[model samples]
Target: MSESGGTFDLVILGAGSGGYAAAIRASELGKSVALIEKDKLGGTCLHYGCIPTKALLHAGEVADNARESETFGVQASLQGIDMQGVHKYKDKVVGGLHRGLTGLLKSHGITIVEGEGRLTGTDEVTVNGAVYKGANILLATGSKSRTLPGLELDGEKIISSYEALRLDRVPESVIVLGGGVIGVEFASVWRSFGAEVTIVEALPHLVPVEEESSSKLLERAFRKRGIKYELGTPYESVKTTDSGVSLTLKGGKTVEAELLLVAVGRGPVSEGLGFEEAGIRMERGFVQVDENLHTGVGNIYAVGDLIPTLQLAHVGFAEGIFVAEHIAGLNPVNIDYDGVPRVTYSEPEVASVGITSKIAAERGIETTEFVYNLGGNGKSQILQTQGAVKVIAAKDGPVLGVHMVGSRVGELITESQLIYNWEALPSEVAQLIHPHPTQSEALGEAHMALAGKPLHVHD
Candidate 1:
């Protein structure tokens, strides 16, 4: 192979968040890099995950708000949702991001190989049967949704997040399986579209990873939306017919719906990835790496969902930047997984970071919680959503976890993540005055009370 104009220093697979981030950083460091992507540039998050789902959720919120206008003393009318228009808007959103990525890659002068990449040997890779040699190789193949045994997604009745994102017609009724983040989110969307949704979760609570109190509030909020849930029960099986799907529960109870969404979870995509061929170490399905994000193989690295840390798109971006900087001879800050915030775009919008109150107590840590009622918040009252913020902290130390359930609570989690990760004490946070008559003040008040200096708490 001709060395062309220059010899590439790094070659990366999967032009998703991690891959493009690595390529851009590497280019900035004066490294000639080649990025290979089998599909569109932005990958899953832009195409099917974050961007599209949020758009749908926003539309769903609008639909619900329009229907509930009588409570606000104004009559708003909604004829029906145009599902085709939703798809158009979703596609338009995705296209804009994809175009931006293409422009950025071109400006950086990085070579774009449009094909599936596989490892042929150490420091060498093959894309579309053409060999490319680099000083180092990075594999960042992301994950896909794991299907349940008895409930496979067929894109019509049984569906996954992807199918949910591209739904052309809103179903009259839906039985959502696995009350995880995705499940509850779609349940919110389906319910807003006037579908009677029943969520079946094997866990004892909805959003099991969240604080128990937050989960309870979410349950209460969901019930008011006409969404039914069957928590702590396993779904026996799903039978699809011409009309729709029939879901059987553990107790012989059956739920018939025009659609069934299986939002169980996702698994890493490592099969046929050619990792073993390159002699890279991986466990089960995830790539194994060190603190520096380096695979055991010389100069080769792995990051993102493949690393088994937090399977979040933002986490992948951070890891990709970490890898590029480490290669450029710069020491980057290591991410603490505990401090990484997780959010579900449901009606109540679950978001949290650090330790839940339950986990802290189970570990024998002394903790106290402060709950701020959303009804006490002016902005929440304005939106007619009185969801509260719950903060857990050490008896007299830094904050442990912050959880919330109500309208528009996801935006407040950033403060929680920062405080927990920085070990910011309640006294320290309480000293800063937040703008009054705002929902964020709810956070400030919660901190003040937790610090034993009650501010807005009625005596």
Candidate 2:
């Protein structure tokens, strides 16, 4: 097809989680769809963010487990880490997902267009100077790693998470800035992979967005692993010399390392996309959309990090599917941002959905919280990690939140979010059994407490 392409029902920009899901849904609903991307078929999450990071974490876990195998009554030992082999494994995981996406698009009849997409007008998208008009447009270009001032990333000594994920050789020593989820997750992976890693976060605790107690557990766990850090105080600046990076801290403390990973955070990738000329409303850099995920332009919608909603890949997927259904006249159920689950997949993984205990207090919902210790869980003892599950509920109403920390607590977010978002009552959740002798029993106990009957704990 020429640059002057045929009309489509939907023209989606950036085929990552949101864009691809939207295209498939639109096509299944009998809409002619075109998806444009300048890079990989799957955006950062599939290529760099989620899939590859998890692969690295798995490898690191295996390495660490092998080293500590004696405690598990096994004599497992590791030969050295094969850095190239690590990369090979990560790439293989990403490749499988890439192929899966390709097949899904082909079967759904969504046309894939290769090139950068720009909204030249309200309903017009130009890819490689080819104009394609759509009845509607979706902008899901996603985001990029954001760096602090005076800390320019060269993808080397001063690197970004992008480089951290593709390291061919584990650095002998590394300094990480930003103790958020990304920073700590990489810290966990590298610590397990046998890197001398130190995390420097400006917050008083690691994973600042999580519950204070949860952050404390993660900090204690990392310390147990001997991962060092100068946290709570910001690093004033990073000076790179012939040898390595020298980070100057607030208290005039200085630390040096061969490499630095900046996981400060991510910013929306919306520049040069022509949103200004298209007349779509925007707040800050994110596109402004309504409850239906519709942009100000009648036939235009926005999702993913491009919109001012949550920047999570799952949120993007949900928003994409929601918009497609609204366009197809499905009138699907609206999502409560409060109900969406958020997880940090580090050791003693932090997960939560709905209002935090702190937020519940501020919002004044007359809230009460139930705490169930992972110390009592048989599975937690087996894994040698102890944490807690916190359930927040209205004094006389439904569940308001669920927060968890323990080995592999990320999986709990799914069930927690369901209870919180569905406005499920304590009685409702108490009715469900979470299986026997599993870590999930912690949640069942929390629900039981809120339901006026206690299980595994005396009230």
Candidate 3:
């Protein structure tokens, strides 16, 4: 690590969600930032993960709507999915966003260094024998899709989400390993694209981190859509067949599919990046940081997937802003991780904010909950979606959590997050009138019931 150094107010490694965000904000506050990246500036979320996946999911929605148009009293038929066309659209969306992000960073007067950056010194990052110095260093290396032991990715038969995203066409059948957010979302897309999809989860339920009731509803919906899944089944092994791949479950049951997608989870990309070399403490490859995102080493901070917080990009954005303000000596408020919203964009999307009922009881907090079925919702019936809105509150206190499963319920979670973060009581939320015949009314009804008013909900 030779020093051909240039000093800056801040040095950020890995120009992903957190890194770019911090760079932009710090620059806005009159701080010179050196933002470095090995790959694209927008990183995995924009290039491979969120943006492209959502585009494919939207394509799936289009196919689904076309196929089921008869139910809407429309004569329409889904001829077939043109994956090339779909990919073109997805790439267009990604390209536009990437250009905007790149332009934004440049417009903010942030210096973007393109290379593989490693922390060679406590406040210095080395890329190609060139050292960049900073008053503070922020690590936002992000993450990569993880694979199981003995499961080598060939990028064809056995693949990670990265390779899966580049598939030219939907497989005739897919065995999705792990039923977390990534698993269910990809499965949802494949199923709607007319592919046979089966998900295998070692957990008791799909989307296991969500409320158990919400998981059950999604499972039921998937079943109705002919999306197969095996719950509480551990994966044993896999072998590639001439046709595709064979996945063996723990009980010796076997599943044959065109491909095996290892969507188990993402792991921090903190290894071999000189994190420990710079004396930055780490835990299981994740940079260890305090609530303020400080890494406990001189002028070092970490954010995004690299630090093991919520792996969502928005969380990364929030952490980036927090770190910038903290370094500016602004005494920024610490994030309430519990209040961060989570969503799984499946056919019946799942979204929640704050704590689940299971967590409430585990913490010895008394709670009362009310469920408003989407069956009674006018908008839901019109959309032909099945789900419910659940409101959980302290016995006589503020609304603590709002969980829902239905189409576009992710949008409603924003309001739920506001209610939870503001510590609004059920009565407080109930006082606000929700517009008539909308899916949001389901949330309103639940809050009303929880507030003891029971509007449109039976006692």
Candidate 4:
């Protein structure tokens, strides 16, 4: 391999959210950086994962609103979904964001290397027969869609999220193979687009990682929307049929659909990139990092989905900033994983922050919990949405967790994130006023009830 003959202060592999964030922050802190990416600069979140999927979800929302316009006395009707037009709209949104991100990176003056990079030494990454050395190397390679042991993605009858986003037409029927965020979001989108959708989850509840109450609420909403789901049943096998595909569950129950989407989870892209050979510890393909995200090998570090963290894009962004500051000797604080907000942007959204009641019980912490129904909130009434906000707190301590299920509750999660991260007491939050006729008041009322005061709630 030929030598590039120059060493940067920081070299980041994978120009996804984490890698680009580190590059920008390190450049701002007056450090020379090299960002190597084999794919688009904005990475999965930009091109295929977060941005495109959310765009499709928004289109689905528009379609739903049009179909139900008479409920608001608007007297409107939704025409059939045009797949080509929907894809065009989604592509436009992605294109604009991609251009903006590219310009931003250029303005930061960080070197962008276009190739697949491999860790060759403690401080060297080889790409295209040229070795680029760095004072510190960061492994920011992100993640990809995961499949079950016997299942394989063919980009046709059986597919992953990547192919789902690029489909030219909506299937007549679909069987989504998981019930996590990705599964539910796609299920919601397809049902809204007028398709027969069935979700088969081995877990007991949809979005099992969320609070049980939130999961039950979402399940209720999905039932009302006519989204079919088979819970607690593991699929034993799948076979492609002439019309589409057939899936068989453990108990011999069979499900047939025009397509099957595998949305179980995402696994880190850490294989054959020379991470293990460089002496970096790994667990199940995920890089093992210390509390500070250090690999304990030279000045090497790993961030984003590459490490076994939250895997959310925002988490990746935060970790990237923290690592850049740490490398700059700014001594940044480590992130509290619980404080990161999680949102599932389905028709009736689900959002939460901080520890769940189950997690609290697992940690042997005593807690007090309260649930405030949206039925009591004027804004929810105005929107004609049914849901509730639940808050969990220490018996005499601060707010431990906040969970909500309703339309657009994801927009309210930032406040809950702040409250959780600040460890604010229920009384403290209750003392503050939320605007009248707003869903945010649901959270406020929940806090008030938890603080021994109830206004519109009957005891």
* Leading candidate by lDDT: 4
Clashing pairs in 1: none
Candidate 3 C-alpha lDDT tens digits along 268-326 = 99888888988888888999888899989998999999987899999999999999988
> Per-residue error at 75 for model 3, in Å?
0.9
Off by over 4 Å in 3: 1-5
| Best of the two (2, 3) by lDDT | 3
TM-score of 3: 0.98
Name the regions of candidate 4 deviating beyond 4 angstroms.
Answer: 1-5
Which rank order by lDDT, best down to worst?
4, 3, 2, 1
User: What C-alpha lDDT values do all the predictions have?
Assistant: 0.84, 0.86, 0.92, 0.94
In model 2, where do residues sit more than 4 Å from their true spots?
A: 1-4
Tell me the tens digit of each residue's lDDT in model 2 across 392-414: 89988899988888888888888
**Model 2 residue 196 CA deviation in Å:** 1.6
Give TM-scores for every candidate, taking all chains together and pairing residue i with residue i.
0.95, 0.97, 0.98, 0.98
- Structure candidate 3, residue pairs in collision: none
Judged by lDDT relative to the true structure, which candidate is superior, 2 or 4?
4
